[model samples]
Target: MSMGKKILIIGPSWVGDMVMAQSLFILLKQQDPDNQIDVLAPAWSRPLLARMPQVRQAVDMPVGHGSLMWSARRQIGRALKAEGYDQAILLPNSFKSALIPLFAGIPVRTGWKGEFRYGLVNDIRLLDEARYPLMVQRFDALAYPAGAPLPEKLPVPDLHAEAARVPQLRAQFGLDGTQKILALCPGAEFGPAKRWPERHYAAVAAHKLAQGWQVWLLGSEKDRAVAENIIAALPQAQRQRCHNLAGVTKLEDAIDLLSVCDAVVSNDSGLMHISAALNRPLVVVYGSTSPGFTPPLNEQVAILSIPVDCGPCFQRECPLGHMKCLNDLLPEQVISALEKLVPGHEQAVL
Candidate 1:
């Protein structure tokens, strides 16, 4: 087996997808301890790649999100070609996403077959969605030989930022040192389709606080109002233990705070993936999206999704004008998941 091979991976634009792909990085590292894995991704994903030690370098694909993808691909391909990558794996399923490596003239271009980039990609593997139902399974297929055994189900990548960075951030945020941290991520990028009811989140947060857990709500500014609503529902005494960290921490800081949490309760969002990557015990709520496609990778993680007849639609918005999947999830169900994660919290065993 050759060592020091340069592999350039075209990463997924979404944060959660990136987290799911981390297992591929782990496999590549295991094959050759000295392997050089570089990533070409959108500017926002750079912070995430920074935390992964397997990546030798991350080249930002300098382009806006909308159309105009070709122009950006050419630019990224030119930059990657200069670095002399031996092989390239395209993670995102778009013809435009493969353009960079084609233009760069990388020797082996590998990816799934959906993109119809015949000339651009050399080693296109035919993907049978039925055989490989999960997103991680599809991602792993890209790296292996035609029918090689899948890499041992490795734990999701656990890459921490500098040790000093997390502590400084904890102090900056005024997080309680003595209390067990319970990270709450109440927002979903897939609109309101996958979001659990705010009242259930509040109830669960209040319940955890009564047991001496500190609730740190996590989300972007778009989620601040929802976080605020949950905070308001908590009792005044328990509310003091609930710190709204929304709109404050950057993506990197969010990872740091998540690292410290004893467990995280989150909607099916990028934050949930991040917590799973950190190996933190996670309770993920599901609604519109099916766990079959994008479940958390850790065995320690618990996923709760009410299987409604209209579910697995994968729609951004509820199509039936009702979101019963999330609205109907009880606070007690969430509390039960958390109790199993929390040490010394005894509950009736199933």
Candidate 2:
């Protein structure tokens, strides 16, 4: 038996991208069972990497996103020289993302040609978006030779949750995990354009609560207000069953807790990807963005979007005053999608 190749991957900064990167890791491991994979990512992604079984270890990228701290990157890169990584795969297209591996003197650095990353990455492949339509496809392609045919059955990211901590997390959050859980992720880090209306979320929550299910609102502190608004929209009795855990739980806690959800209704956000990776029955709503590019990788997912003329603009906020793309997308549509993904739920309230 021979020790396989050791690879260092410069991971993406966003949570969703990091989740998708697991596909590439799975592909590498599938190709070579002995392959050792280490991820270089932001500190926030450490918990995410921990959930990925393919990752041997996660090295935190000292430099923040968009920061070109040459000396800092050099220091970190030089420090990793002792690891003797056989190959470095850069997931981000930024020129800065390629610098560390180059500085570390890692042989066979691989990535797409972006931002004039000519000499920085020796094994650069010009990306053909038409050929590789999905982001996961592009990432998985790097695991093989340039222009090589990707596996017909690409592995979807399946994140492992710390089930032992489920009890502790439930106790900490005053949740018993006795009732059916329906998680609603209404916040989009991308911006307001991607967020489904709060009232719409409330409608879903109200319906689930009527069916004797608990609603868990998930997001960062930035989404606390939105979560609160959703709860406020619910009737007083329904609000009692709703948990506003948006700002309350850490990323890891959210991951473990989300594993127990019977179903999830979310915007096209990081948590949406997380829920899908957990293999939860997911209903994802898209507004400013379209599913053509980064649809949920899970099989049990329903993506809902209303097409408008001004649409899929991929903007932070709607350019026109009316956000008909999202506002026009009724809660009933999402509830219908959810019922399709997870049957036996009560009919939605119009």
Candidate 3:
């Protein structure tokens, strides 16, 4: 039993990756209740870290992702030395990600052997994709000794939302709590390749609205245009019932608001992971990416992806000049998946 061992985690920069990292935090707490877990991530992830009970605190990483700010890394690492973190876990497989922990002089630095991070991480493990197929599994493996068998039942990421704030957020957004809410996440930060067609999203929104459900489009400021396009495609009556909340609410507000949603239809983006963590019924549409690697870590999720010969290409955009993978995926498929995921919704209006 490692008692009172403080651990520091170099978290991933992407939103979905940060959410999935909670599984590792849960495993650390399970291993020893006295373990103090702190995350070093981007400034934006503070709100996310607040939702995870296992995290003691979130230290903002001063350097931007992929930036080789040697002096900044050294300063941050030296500053954390007094806290005396027993171990530092590196979530990103980048050489730069290991620099801070190494400079901090943490005794045990653990991570996968990525990008010549040989001496940077003292307790490095070679990743076996088959053994740890899911991203959650890879994160959890860092908590245990090398070659140790993982627990049969791994803990899933469950973010805690403030029920009290739900109503306040709804009021702030002028949302009606009387109707069943269907949250639509139509943007993917990775790029357009991962995003489902906006017309498809409008179709789902229209169908749900006709069935007496309110639609809420959720995303960051970058997604506002896409949200508007979805609304523009809908009839005025249906658009009246659809609320475009993208770029309006803070991430924390979105988190609390999403908790109140009956179901969520999203691309394989960060909000999809957030919705899953909130335990909402989720239908994730995958285009360029495949769910075989990083599926939403929730039982209530229905993954929709078309098998295209050019697909699972994992590119930022379509290489063949056509996004047939997402374009070919009909809205009816997503609606049917939603009906199966959440009962009582009317059949998709073609």
The TM-score leader among the candidates is 2
List, residue by residue over 181-282, the lDDT tens digit for candidate 1: 889999987789988989999998887787777899999999999999999998887887899999899998898888888889999999999988888989
Clashing pairs in 2: none
Model 1 error, position 133 (Å): 1.3
Write candidate 3's Cα lDDT for 1-350 as tens digits.
45778999999999999999999999999888899999999999999999999999999997999799999999999999998989999999999999999888999999999998999999999999999998889999999999899999999999999889987887887999788899999989999999999999999988898888889999999999999999999998777789999999899988999999999999999999999999999999998898987889999988888888987999989999799999999999988988888888554433
- Assess each prediction's global lDDT (C-alpha) against the native: 0.84, 0.93, 0.92
Residue-level lDDT for 339 in candidate 2:
78
Please report the candidate that would top lDDT against the real structure.
2
How good is model 2 by TM-score?
A: 0.98
RMSD to native, candidate 2? 1.7
Each model's total of backbone clashes: 0, 0, 0
Give candidates' CA RMSD values in order: 3.0, 1.7, 1.9
> Over 4 Å off in model 1, which ranges?
152-155, 345-350
Record all residue pairs in model 3 with backbone atoms less than 3 Å apart, i.e. clashing: none
Clashing pairs in 1: none
- Shift in Å, residue 119, candidate 1: 0.8
